[model samples]
Target: MEFYGKGNLWNFVEEERRNMHFTRSLSFSTDQNVSEPHESPFVSPKASSASATSIPLSPMSPETPWKLSPMHASPSPSLLYHCLASLHRYEGNVFSIAISRDFIFTGSESSRIHTWKRPDCTEVGHIKASSPDVRAILAHGRILFTTHGDCKIRVWDVSVTEKFRPKKITTLPHRNPFFLFPKKNSHQHKDYISCLAYNDGEKLLYTGSWDKSVKVWNIFEKRCVDSFVAHEGHINAIVINQQDGCVFTCSSDGAVKIWRRVYGESSHILTMTLKFQLSPVNTLALSSSPSSCFLYSGSSDGLINFWDKEKTSGRFNHCGFLQGHHFAVLCLATIRELILSGSEDATIRVWRREEGHCFHSCLAVMDGHHGPVRCLAASLEIEGLLVYSASLDRTFKVWRVKLLTPEKAAMEELVVTNDQQTEIEECKMSPVLSPSWVEKKIQANHFQ
Candidate 1:
């Protein structure tokens, strides 16, 4: 298939991968294709982010825990800010980023997956995958899996050494492409692969695509074992819950559906559908605590709807929504009981969930990235929590969030308040908001 993605503008020289430049000034592509929704001008510079000279809002008074000081504003900048260790290494938009125990990997329009030494940001190596545009990257050990615009997924074996070289261990599409995958009249995803999720225990890899199909692949065998049509529109993201063996997928269709594995069978069955989203669902994430699990979905309309099990229908219920962004919510990352979401507003808002509460309070907003925040990764530092965020502005920022006082956060009493209101209305026959709030109380619940 011919590639038409925004990454296709660059044609890198594969043979020169080992000799790629390490400086941020390196030029790989001349095209700068950024979406307008991320560049909205509705926020004043002071109200949108943290300021160095601004006075603090009396520490927000412990009683008003999650109420951010800024009015559609985020928490104080001092609580969460950008790390000076940030680097603008990529020449184009950094689409996908992955984090491991000791290293970080990022893929972009350059087709080469760049590796850097962690704790101290330094370029170590670069591997040129065959595909010129790598859309998604997920790492499981020494093995690196990447999806691209060619409708193909490739696996690589590599090392973290200065002299490390990447060898192409496997390619998903064999010679008999259409034999295993039938022609669905071009409605299905015979196109670019957008996102990927790996089930370590099941040894299965799930790939979502622009063609709107979720195909399960056995990475060890380089063969697609199972295939299913997940959504009526293009599939954006896929995440699995290992505890219950459930798979959740969100799409441009403005719906988030739940699917479960069939016992003794290789396929899955659709269980329930969660709808009423005002915009196309862009991403979904599942966070599990010792007692319960929480499901979060982000949309183009800049709202996040969380789902939990309800006894009334025995299906996932739209508990409530969280609102701190004025643009599309692009990605979400969970750190313990706290949820950190990145958005086209070019900010990352941090929210905390108390043990017994279901509603979350906005704690701080990290406005370090220059462009629309596309992806996020988190790790532990001996002294603080490190959050790595990638953006369309061709730069990545590392943040240091001060959540050191876990005991203080627990002792503090929060009077959960609902100041904003949005409802799920009947599905309108509109253009899905073209893809493309909550002031609800937080309560402790589970989705078993």
Candidate 2:
């Protein structure tokens, strides 16, 4: 037993060393080895227990005492990303993710949604909706909404957490209406519920499904209020702009449509139909800067279409494109002016908004997940960002990211800037960098 504080220097050092050893063990036991400074961004499929590279980004400064290493060795002009934690438990691909004030929810192909504590990846509870895949999740006041491949929308009352069990309040369609009314059957969605959105003020929930239909439900009533075949292909995602009373829906049919509620009419009007998109729109995000609000749509291809409100036309017009990801942009997350996109190429790209323009520059590429990234959630912190990424590889990782904090960034900019430095240059010069010679240079640059 030992005390910890200013006076207990030896005890603190011993505790820190144990923590370092524990973290290293977790990293190595999680089915991969530590990555070298050069061979980063992607963990090779051939990684073994014997191989290693665990370098934390926070240089052992007096202010901080922990381990972290940048996931991308290639300099991002002025940014760096570090892995904070990695959680692996699901048996299949992780499809969707949601972050609440107190919990983190992840839906997967294993037919369950796993719940963890907000600050750390501590297992708290889980709900097995059915034998089919849970494709999406939404957190409201006290209820958790989940869309499943079994073509159903399940409402979970999470307030009743007696034994980590959330009660399934009701399923849509309320059993079958055939007994009540033959024509109005109990069939809610014929295919799958792909996405969900909610409007707090209106007290309604919107769902998009693979049946090429969008359905509106009164959460309090647990009944489908309206249903319409709104797309030609399977609906991919839905997002609500409550301030403008706009419902944006994306589909595999390669189009995004906007709907608005009429004052007295029971049905919503199709206000706009965005066309000319050659690829199927897969996800949608609303980004707000100090000056304006913009809508971003991720596609089956690697392009993310940017649309801004046209003051003159009073409609959303195509502003430009944020083109970075090489494969399909599966998910998108926005925090203030920053945009994060996860793609089918098994990497996440961070982009910083240019303040006044619709275009954005790629800041860093995080390559740790071995499968296509399926979902991402980001929350702003006082100094940086806490980002969570879910992958089809059956694991979700938490990352800590900040831009331009190291004194060595300016000098290291010219040393290693891209992938070319990893293979040809490092192999050619590695033979000359001896242990003593490297140690001398590292000590001389202590400020880094």
Candidate 3:
């Protein structure tokens, strides 16, 4: 079957894997070469076993506790940050990222699965299946739902622990897979499934696919509850606000449609539409707040547009726009009042919402990768303190806002002092003597 954007899609996935392998191999080789004696300059001499194992103690009460005076205390930095580890390396650019209560999940083009621990970013498991590429992943209750390029959606029962093993349960076939592509063997028929959303309270799974349709599935019954032709072109994204019983979908045809499902019905009734003709909407995210009722959507044109549900229509109704990314904006996440956006320009931007519907200027521009950032996930458990991002570079990065406590500050000080003392001792043990000492010894030898 043909697929829309097939060239770009295949290249994106292949580039990711190639970059990941290249970087890992380069680092490994560099470390190996640096281990040789002539290549390393900071190697320490082997220490005597007795000296290494022994630590002298002052004659003080064994139970005595150390106390710090107020004068010795210092203010700590508001945040500390570091890259813990890369979660997974994909052959295709990761298009979606989701974090459950315990595990981190990502969808990539190689038709493979990648998972890691929440917040820690430790690799847990992976699966390579026959599905066309996966575009989005949603975790609801014990089940994880994924949308793919094969015009099918799969449901998996995932273990909510460190092991992260997911068992495939059901696959919902597309009702109108042919709608995705008119020509057989055409590149447009690959049927890229772009988004997945679930209403666990109602036991429903909703998927947006390139077939230009949104499908609702009954999770318990393992059957499609309802299917609707919601877009004129490929449905690139979909998000369901279960709290409000509202589902939002966007397509390459350049429009955002909102559907409201009646409390007891299977079909979704169309409510409203937000139209933009310049670019296709690539991602969508809803705010948790009610009064603000804000929804953010990123587009292929690199502008992050904010829409307020309260404002119905017309020129003055737009909320605001985030303009910084040089290329297309691919993904977005909301953590409290902050909004995070990942772009094809190879940067992740953080923005904060201020009072009166306006957002503060960019809070931070995270940079470290050489390729486009394809997906981003923020920890709901950490109160907007940690962020995880996946890129076309074939790596996932975990970032945290460092919160330094009194204990951590003291430990850092102690570490610095110990390092300084070690450097001083090393200086004293050096083989070269001072010129003054050598001259005095030569004078004494002449007198003798």
TM-scores for the candidates: 0.72, 0.73, 0.68
RMSD of each: 13.2, 15.6, 17.1
Q: How would you encode candidate 1's per-residue C-alpha lDDT over 200-267 as one tens digit per residue?
A: 88888888887778888877776777788898877888888776667899988888988887897878
lDDT of 3: 0.62
Candidate number of the best lDDT: 2
Local accuracy by lDDT, each model: 0.64, 0.68, 0.62
Better of 1 and 3 by TM-score: 1
Query: To one decimal, what is the Cα RMSD in angstroms of model 2 from the true structure?
Result: 15.6
The residue pairs found clashing in candidate 2 are 34-53, 56-68, 56-69, 57-68, 57-69
TM-score ranking from best candidate downward: 2, 1, 3
1 versus 2: better lDDT goes to: 2
For 267-315, candidate 3 gives per-residue lDDT tens digits of 8888888875457777888775654667788887788888766544511
Model 3 ranges off by over 4 Å: 1-81, 87-90, 161-165, 174-190, 311-316, 380-384, 402-448
Q: Candidate 2, after superposition: displacement of residue 125 in Å?
A: 1.8
